[model samples]
Target: MAKTIFITGASRGFGKLWAAAFLEKGHKVVATARDLRSLDDLVNKYGTNILPLQLDVNDRAADFAAIAQAKQHFGSIDVLINNAGYGLFGSIEETTEQQAREQMETNFFGLLWLTQAVLPVMRAQGHGHIIQLSSVLGLVTVPILGLYNASKFAVEGLSESLAQEVKAFGINVTLVEPNQFATDWGSASAAVTTPMPEYDGARAWLQAAASEDKIGIPEATVPAILQLIDSENPPLRLLLGKQGHPWTRQVYEGRFAEWDAWQEIAAAAHGK
Candidate 1:
């Protein structure tokens, strides 16, 4: 069962880890990154089993072309891992228009273009699996990470609709929602906005949460991802990390409580 896996953002983080894992498992991987040189080690080790491509996920044209190239190279793509995105650190009031746009462009639009490009190929083959790399923040919002939360929320909603639309086509869609990890995602790799004194108190929770104890090991996610990809019937959403469950449950419970509290208002508004 050596399937071809087309992975975006393969230079580092989960992308790099998963690409190497899949290669070690004898699966052909089309590894893409902004800089192909970043993937040199994977190529050097895995040889022809890995096709390292230079890709800026924001480019729609490049996404389609990359999909075509991968299909032509492997003859079939059994899975797609959209692991390409970065965190944007800023309070909602401090976020700029450019910051919001760029965040959406890379996280949401980029994944959309690639998914659109791969649809036809998967349809023809009659089966495929698409794994979206969302965040636990996608389920519950946190201060200082507003824009990143928005992008992942968009991903969650898009994937929900997509799963229903593609079920008849035998395509499986899964949203992998992971909590904070020990990575450069929110540090060196993130885009930080100028901090404002007004939000300093609001941002304290984030600063306090930034420690080794709060983050999971990036490599620990490999087995969870492998099980997800290898399953015949994968779940629509998979939450990773010990922190994800409690946070998500609390958010959901609060939402239900609010909904129940507002039921009367909702009914009154619906009255004809």
Candidate 2:
């Protein structure tokens, strides 16, 4: 079946890779980027099968407009992939108010607006799959990537709730939680705050712990993503890399141990 997939941030990273994959598979793609020119090759190669649009997901009006345009162009949208987000690399103390606001605007609010815009369309059709691009940081935190973790964590919670709410409408939601990959997330598409001297030790520790071998290849995720979108029963949450499951398990196991140890105190605190 040739499905129509509406995806944001299709200029690069996993977004571009997946867009090309779908087109190659004879599916139609409405690929969006902040800069329309970034999608020139795809537009040229795929021709009528691909609609390259300029979209800044932070703009609520633009999100609605883009959805309308896509719905008008393609009779129906089979899938919506929220892959537009950038990383904010900084400690909590180093992060400024403006930077924090901007991160939330694009990462959380942007996805929220687009999802809201697409809901009516999906409801009318009575079928759709929404794929949210989250991160391993959403499950477990790292030292310097605080804001990025916060944004993904927000997506995780929102998508979980959305999955339940839309199930009766025949709309499925899936959270794709990817670990570190060979993507532009940390380099080209990231914002870095001014370094504070107080966090130098923590920065050194983070740097020392970095391992290039652990980074998964971005291209490897396409098949899994395609399989997910094609399935009649997709998971509410899907972890993308080898480390995501084990790493999250360890983190949660510790949480469980702590909660169990303090179970008596926690129960006593509940007043009748």
Candidate 3:
């Protein structure tokens, strides 16, 4: 059963691969990028099924226009994937306020605006899936990447709440958490200045830990994403790489365990 799909940031990275995978599966894909020229190869290959459109998710009017065009082109969008985001790495003190807000604007608010734009269309059709491209960083906070982590963390919270809100309307929300995957995201991460000369040693360690070269097979995520789209019951959170599984579980488990341990004390303090 081929369905119409609309994806942002389809010029490259996971968005590009996902667009290709859907096209290969005989689905109609409205692939969008900030520059339509970057998607020329995909346009040439898929021709009719792949409609490359110019879209900058941060632009509210432009994003709405893109969504309208997709609906008009494919009748209705069965799947909407919000993958237009970038990584901005820096410590809280080292990064400027403007830089921090910009990160949230692109990674968090941009996704929100797009989701809002597509919701009515999905609800009108009676069913649709919305996929949000998040990062393992969203689950855990690491050194130096505070800004990037904060942005993704916001998405994690947004998706969790949005999932419940739209569940009644037959709309599903999925969050994609990739370990490292060979993408240009690492190179695009914001460069932060080291305020303290003494922290030089720590900064180097953070850089190595966050390197993109350590991750493998960026294409692996696309299969899981597609599987969720096709499944009758898909998980709200989709962890991409095997390397991230244990760590991600541990983070949540550890936090829950600690919270449980403090429950009695918390209740007593609140006069419960």
Q: For model 3, give the RMSD to the true fold.
A: 1.9
Give the alpha carbon lDDT tens digit for every residue of 1-272 in model 1.
89999999998888999999999999999999998989999899999999999999999999999999999998999999999999989899899999999999999999999999999999999999999999898999888998999999999999999999999999999999999898789777799889999999878878887667879999999999888889999999999899999989998999999999999999899976
Using all chains and alpha carbons, the TM-scores for the candidates as numbered come to 0.98, 0.99, 0.93
lDDT of 3 by residue, 1-272 (tens): 89899999888888889899999999999988988998898888888998888877888888888899889888999999999888765556777878888888889888998899999999999999999999888998778778889889999999999999999889999998888777787775334544666666667888777566668687766677778889777789888887678887888999999999999998899974
Clashing pairs in 2: none
- Poorest 10 consecutive residues by lDDT, candidate 3: 188-197
Off by over 4 Å in 2: none
lDDT of 2 by residue, 17-69 (tens): 99999999999999999999989999889899999989999999999999999
Q: Model 1 segments beyond 4 Å from truth?
A: none
Predictions in order: lDDT: 0.94, 0.93, 0.85
Better of 2 and 3 by lDDT: 2
TM-score of 3: 0.93
